[model samples]
Target: MKAIVFGSTGFIGSHTVEQLILKGHKVTAVVRSHSNVAFLQSLDVRIVEIDYSDTASIKEEIEGHEVVYNCIGSVGLRSKIDLENAVEIDLTKKLVRAASLSGANRFIQLSSIVVYDFHSSEPLDESYCIKPQYLIQQLLLKREEVVRKIGEETGITTIILRPASAIGRRDYMSFFSRLFQQHMNDQFPLLKNGETKVSLVDTRDVGRAMEWLGNYPFPKGSMNLFLLKGFDTTWKSLKEEIDYERGIEVTICDLSNIVEDPVSYTLNTFRTHRVWNDEKIRKLGFTTKYSQRESVKDAVQDFRDRERI
Candidate 1:
């Protein structure tokens, strides 16, 4: 299949492009002119630069592609200018509209599991009701709704994948990656006992899942949602993995006493034990290749290689 991956320079996007190429699919990586292409340059892909703000140009570039992977979005914990919602929703709308006009066979959207209620005691599944607690969560939910409506009306086979916190090679902005970097600098903080379980997925597995979906036989105009989780582990376990990998026992700073508005919310988010029922995709024969331990080790190695440490 001929595929075009937007935002192909970023973490998930780069991995997705790699998986697509490895699966014998011809891939065209689309990115902004100023975006870094160091990783994409290493792969056997046709890279195209375009302004995402221009729908005509997007449609022109997307014309010859059978599949359009919309991996464009902001990832991180920041509320400045409502950046998450603005970039995610606005760019998604443009991409969908262009893909519809360009006659693309399928549109794959990369969404986050954060759309589900973060504090839920039960495991989150695709059928679980979306009750986002904060500003970014609210916007992500809104983005999914927009995709559903646009897909139904435009008759595009659209798939929305809500992946857990992604970490591995090319990971920079994820929670675990930041935590690992902080740990390396001896400034990592632990919430309470650091026993809260966090659901995480490997970016490579996510890319594999996207490639599988691209070839799946779904009816045109159908909208499907799937949850992708690689493995479940606790904060303490992750920290221990880092310690063992780096060969050091670092001092843990207690954040259990901090109780305020934004600070408390951010800390409590990591503190909350979140589990995902990602069985839907797995039952369909989608298997994850990376374990929690492997993911942590790879992420650590990637960081070291990048920093030349």
Candidate 2:
């Protein structure tokens, strides 16, 4: 199978490219000119640098690929919130239009589970209502809408994947990563005694799921959505796991005293229980390789090995 992946340099995108290659699929990794392709360069695939601002060029680049994977996203936690939201929404609109024009067999979008109204104690699935609250979550909801509309109008097969918190190597920007880093540096923040539940999925498993969906045969003009959930655990349990792995007791600070920063906002996400039911995808023969504890352990070890602590 031939696949074209946008945002190939990102955490989840990088793993997806690697998995596709390992499965003997022909991949074209689309990246920006300033992207660090050191890892991608080592892989057996075609690397294409294209101007994201030019929709025509993006369309041309995606042409002839059996599957177009949209993983492009903004790492704009530190930037102007409005600008970041605009950029994300605009890019998604362009990608959907470009993929539709390219006539790809399937368009796989890497969405987030936060789009769902996750206040309920029951697990969320594709049927859950979308009631995004945060600025970022609102933008994601809009992005998903654009893809769905375009896919329906153009008669293209669209698959939307709402993956839970992803954990593994190359996830230095994730909330869990930041929390782990703070814990290592003795500045961890304790939220409600660190008792909120979090559902985390391994990056490799996310990649495998994308690959499976990309290769799966969908009926013509089908629009499918799935939630990818990993193992579930509480923040306290995760912290204990980290403490046991690192052989040190992390200082847990009062949450109220911690200044409002990106990391703080991230930690606050667990103030509400976030869980998803992925039986829909599981029934499709998709399975995760790592448990939640193992996923967190691997992420911490990866950071340690990189000497980031």
lDDT of 2 by residue, 145-182 (tens): 88899899988899999998888888857777878878
* Candidate achieving the largest TM-score: 1
Residue 96, candidate 2: Cα error in Å is 2.0
User: Which pairs clash in model 1?
Assistant: none
lDDT of 1: 0.84
C-alpha TM-scores of all predictions: 0.95, 0.91
RMSD of 1: 1.8
| Candidate 2, lDDT over the whole model | 0.82
Worst 10 residues of 1 by lDDT: 76-85
lDDT of 1 at 196: 82
Maximum-lDDT candidate: 1
Superposed model 2: Cα runs more than 4 Å off: 75-79, 83-85, 256-268
Q: 148-251 in candidate 1: lDDT tens per residue?
A: 88898899989999898888898777777778878977866778678888788888899999999999988878999999999988878878888988989888
